[model samples]
Every structure is written in structure tokens, then in C-alpha cells.
Target: MDESYFFKLKSVAKDRLSPNGEVAFFLGILLYSGALLGICFFAIYYAVDFKKTSELFKGLFIGSGVMIILLIILFCLCVLFEKMVFKIQKIIGVVTVLYTIFIAYFPFFYFFIYLA
Candidate 1:
């Protein structure tokens, strides 16, 4: 019913924040932001090039391909830090559950925000 009721990923992420874990989380945020920015970059770069449904499909596939690559890269980094992650697994568990709840809230969240 309210957008303010939306869950924050940061809150759970914060509870798990350790010096090293913070670094890894920071890295995730960094990579996440970078990947997002890179997507925006290419999306704009090809804005004029996608003139048809076929081109739009090509663009979508390319964007998805890039996202998959980024996810695998991030996954490897997470594995590299797996030893540290064990300590934070409980926190991550809560984060995951909260994230699932957050997904459900997102439509209401965005709809209200859009109205605002």
C-alpha cells in the first residue's frame, strides 16, 4: 500500500558488513554500478542503430549477453571470497528473503513513486 514500506537491500547488506565483507560488498556495488553504467553507455551508443524489431531483438540479446557475462564474473569474485562469506551466510540468508519480499513490493513501489 505504501512505497515507503519497500524493503532496502542495503539494510540487510549492512548487518553483514565486516571489514573484508564490506570490501567485497563494496566490490559488488562497484561492479553492479559499473555494469549498469556500461549498459546505459551502449544503450545510448546504439540508440540510432536499432531501427527495427530485429535490431531491437539484437540489442536485447546483446544486453542480456553482457549481463550474463557480468553475473558470471561477479559470481567468480564471490567464490573467491567464499571463505569470508561463511561468516555472513546467515545475514545473506535474511538478505535473500528480504529481497524476495522486495521483489513483490517493487510494482507497488514503482507505481506509487511514478504517481508521486
Candidate 2:
């Protein structure tokens, strides 16, 4: 009876901590993917102009295209390497947090420095 009680308690704790590891992993990937898309959109938006800025336009187009390609590749990799992601869940969590911070900060910082 005591052993069964302990097992139930352990499972409850585990569920509380993670709930569902796969869901968490995919949610993290989704967030990063959205951020990458946002970056690509901003890059393209800022890069284009109706003036004679051929070089700048070309560079921005190429950079933004490359970023989109990279984002697709990352999505594919995450889908293919589910086991690996689960193994490195902690590292993924840390990186996701840092990336989120950068994504959130960039626009705010830009507006503060340039617009304000």
C-alpha cells in the first residue's frame, strides 16, 4: 500500500513538472519558428525602397531569403530529430528563452534608439 502511494505521488510530481514533454518541445519550436518568420518579414520590409539603392536592396533580399531557408531547415531538423530534442530538452529550453529575449528586445531597442 505504501509503495503504491509513493508511486502515485512521484507520478503526480512528474506530471506537474513537465506535464507533457513532447508538447513542450513542439511549443518551443513553434515559438522560435514564429520569431524567425517575424525577423524575415522585418528584414524584407526594411530592406526594400523605391529608390536607387540596388546594392542595399540586393543584400537585404539575399539575407532575408537565406534566413527563411534556414528557418525551414531548422523546422525540418526538429521534426526529424524528435528523440534528440527530448534528450537535450533542458538546453533547448535555455536557448529558447535567450532567443525570445533577443527577439523581444530588438524592436524595443530600435524604437528607443532611433524613433524615440
Q: Pick by lDDT: which candidate is best?
A: 2
Clashing pairs in 2: none
Superposition error at 31 for model 1 (Å) = 12
TM-scores of all models? 0.33, 0.42
Which pairs clash in model 1? none
Q: After superposition, how far is residue 96 of candidate 2 from its true place, in Å?
A: 1.7
Model 1, global lDDT: 0.49
Which runs of model 2 end up more than 4 angstroms from their true locations? 1-75, 110-116
Span of 10 residues, lowest total lDDT, candidate 1: 107-116
Score candidate 1 by TM-score against the native: 0.33
Evaluated at residue 68, the lDDT of candidate 2 is 41
**Candidate topping TM-score:** 2
Write model 1 residue lDDT over 1-116, tens digit each, in one string.
46544445555555654435544554554455455545544554466343433554455546544644654564465568867566666665564454345434433532332232
